[model samples]
Target chain A: MRVLGVDPGLTRCGIGVVDGQPGRPISLVDVFVVRTPPTDDIGARLLGVERELERMLATHRPDAVAVERVFSQHNVRTVMGTAQAGAVAIVAAARHGIPVALHTPSEVKAAVTGSGRADKDQVGVMVTRLLRLDAMPKPADAADALALAICHLWRGAANARLSAAAAKVPVSRLPKGSAQKGWR
Target chain B: MRVLGVDPGLTRCGIGVVDGQPGRPISLVDVFVVRTPPTDDIGARLLGVERELERMLATHRPDAVAVERVFSQHNVRTVMGTAQAGAVAIVAAARHGIPVALHTPSEVKAAVTGSGRADKDQVGVMVTRLLRLDAMPKPADAADALALAICHLWRGAANARLSAAAAKVPVSRLPKGSAQKGWR
Candidate 1:
């Protein structure tokens, strides 16, 4: 399965595409960033984000899209930025008909670095190692996007395996609430 | 000057247009809301925002756009929504090459109600009185957008007067560092 991950922002957005197949490790297909000029009208900047996302979808054609869920602290300005980024990602994924999944920053960090408290650099290094990249991703946003994609890949595989196992087992033999209990 | 005000959101965006002329009260040209499907792709939804914004701009030919700045709070999900809405507003204005202005929720409220801490209902009531609307603008988002435009009109005019006054003031009369402190 091909997964496209996004780290959304108003001024700049980071995008990463990863491919995963049965019995093969997830591979980074592409990574890039889209930016909106500060001097441009806000409406135009949103259009730029939309257009860039459309272009990415057409070019990469990933099976799924993964994005970071919003996490806010005390700063209202930062919260606003986080919300704007989340909205853009949601709008982009909804337009394409590709299933979209949201992962928290902590979840992604843990999946990539084996620690939920991992810093951006640590996550970047782990993502580089996991994807076998020659070097770490340049911008921290790109690295976060990659980590989000990796988290999805790992969780998605686990979900698929559990689904398959359930399919083979008789309904009576399965433990109660087993379906609801795993990998949400 | 004609100004378009936007209240952006994932599911619905509120838009209001106002015409501002010298020595006359601001006139409400039009008001409407745009809705997007929740399940649609993110790209398509953003396109929807773009298309709706373009239609508003084409119909009204606004000279400027006014938008609310995002405020972060304790809720991550709410912050995400605000961010998305802000981005959509920014992109819409940018696409048309129209100058854009941002106002905080408190600033807009203060302009309309003389109190930055005023609640939405108070602001709505004040907007109705200020614009002489037949009824309070329906939908909180629509009212908020109208208030944004009103806030811009009030502040923009004040800013212009301040600038003109500063331009005429003699440098010799001003205290050292006073120029930098004036109307920044």
Candidate 2:
């Protein structure tokens, strides 16, 4: 399934599209960034992001959208801006009837580099190799977006399989203690 | 000026509209909440907020929008959702060319109750008295939103006067020592 990954930010938001599924080679479809002037009013800045994301959703038509979830940050202002930008992306996808997934930064790193603690350079290198790009995507946000899409493609497909498998299992076959274990 | 104030949240976003100027007594136009089910997907929840806020903006056609600036919270998830909801309100206002202002929780409380650290009950009581309502607005969110609009009406008017006064001052006429002080 095709996936659109967004690294949301107020000044610059990254958007990348990747086509692939579990056990299949992934290919990069497109990558770009939408930027707003820092001096602009907050409302105008948000509207710019919303409109650009809406345009991208209409142009790409990805099967699913993956957004980098805003976690805690040293700067509360930055966290708020990121969350707002992320919300615009989420709402854009929802308007298009595209399922959206939120991936933590560490989760995206782990999926791309096999290390949750991997740094930006490691993520960039791995994303380049995974997508078979001639060079690294400029503006670290672009590489990060690609990594997010790759993560969703790999993880989402696996999740779907697990869900399908669980659905096919007969209720009578469930282990006596399975209910207590809880599905994580 | 008519002002629309928003207290944004994922489950329930409070919206209130008030009409008046800085010195004049403010009158409440309307107050209500838009709610989304917790069980819904995050994308769907965000979309619900965006659409509702848009509809409110269209119906009210307020001169300005005031949003409660989401502050840091112990729960990261809650903060993100609040920030996202606030962004939707800001964008909806922006789309209609209505200037948007952000007021911190403490600012709203102080404006309504004369105490930045006032409790919820104090805020609700002051808001009801300020609006000259027979009873308090149901749900603390509704009162909070009304307080936010009141804050914006009073504060925004004062801000405009300050800006206008500053604009009238000529830099060249300032005292030599003023250059070192810098313009605030």
Docking class of 1: acceptable
Highest lDDT scorer:
2
**After TM-score superposition, what is the CA distance of residue B38 in candidate 1 from its true location, in Å?**
7.2
DockQ-based class of model 2:
acceptable
DockQ of each: 0.30, 0.44
User: What's the C-alpha lDDT at position A96 in model 1?
Assistant: 65
What clash pairs does model 2 have?
none
lDDT of 2 by residue, A77-119 (tens): 7777788888888888988899889898998999999999999
lDDT of 2 at B77: 69
TM-score of chain A of each: 0.83, 0.89
Off by over 4 Å in 2: A168-184, B170-184
